[model samples]
Target: MEEFNINSVQVILWKTMENLIEDDFKKFKNHLKVMKDVPLSKLEKADRDDTVELIVQTYTEEFAGKTVVNILKQMNLNQMANDLQEKVLKIELQPMLEKQKAFEDARRAYEQREEQIKTQAKYAEKQINKGYKKFDQALQDEVAAKIAALREEEEQKSQMMKEKIEKMNREISALSDTMRAIEEKMRSDDVTPPQF
Candidate 1:
């Protein structure tokens, strides 16, 4: 059956238990040794079988001797009571059990999805780090190449400057020699006192 139907049946069962506790408390008064002061209103809120079992045990022979079907019969839920009393005692609870199993399955699926998401996130992080590393290395390589180019250019400029300085020095030395030769010729002409 559908989960909603199971939920509805559970609601009906709880209601029946509530009604039994409210209307038939006096009938089971002798069996109310441990649950005498316990409020019937509390049973209205019972959600688990253990709580119902506590109520049933209070009336059973040894506080441990009753089935859920017997409890339902006592509460006048004859149809559901008989249905549960058949060879399969949990027949009436099949839907609820199936619902519980479905919930467990869904929980496992959710956990797996969460794990998958975490794994994907880790993989994405690794990929990003790898890409960044490659980018960083490429950047470093490009910078190094540019720096080497600049250094080579600077070295060429220094060599060109040195060559220009050497050429200028050679031109200055030649000019000085020419000036000395003119001065020596003038001195020789003055000594000779030549006519025009």
Candidate 2:
């Protein structure tokens, strides 16, 4: 394997770091929309100033130093890694990290709001279904009650019709008996034929 120069290694590491920072910055910016509690217009306006503060708070000196040192060590540049770790204060990289941190905060807040909204929607759906079930049960009960009432009324009407038929039959039987008796009397009293 050809021997690698320290300067070339440093240049490659710097380019890699820059690319990573740029990618993270874009991702952070994209996540700003997810902060539902904070309006997009407000965040856009405040981002210029607020990002600096967020970066200061999130990317502390200790964190930055450790990360740079780790990267250098991974590349086998132990001497350069130690030198960079001492010189790489968080403030020097604050501008690069600011947008990335801000985006993360907004993304987290947005996700939380989304979950809460989902839970509320599910609860509302359950309540609506429960209400519908109650309404359906009440309607079914009402219909059943009406049908039972109609059946009782029909039974009463049928009973009345049967009573009327029985009464008519008795009257007809009595009339027939009277006619037979009258005919018998007429036959018994036949002395002379009456001319009509």
Minimum summed lDDT over a 10-residue window in model 2 is located at 1-10
How high is each candidate's TM-score?
0.48, 0.45
lDDT of 1: 0.59
| Model 2 agreement with the true structure over 1-196: per-residue lDDT tens digits | 2222333333333533454444443444344344343355544654433432333234333343455466456556577666666445333455447778899889999999999999999999999999999999999999999999999999999989888888888888888777666666777886443433
Give every collision pair in model 2: none
Give the alpha-carbon lDDT of every model: 0.59, 0.57
| CA lDDT for candidate 2 | 0.57
Model 1: C-alpha RMSD to truth? 11.9
- RMSD of each predicted structure: 11.9, 18.2
Specify the highest-TM-score model's number.
Answer: 1
Q: In model 1, where is the ten-residue run with the lowest total lDDT?
A: 57-66
| Angstrom error at residue 58, model 2 | 30
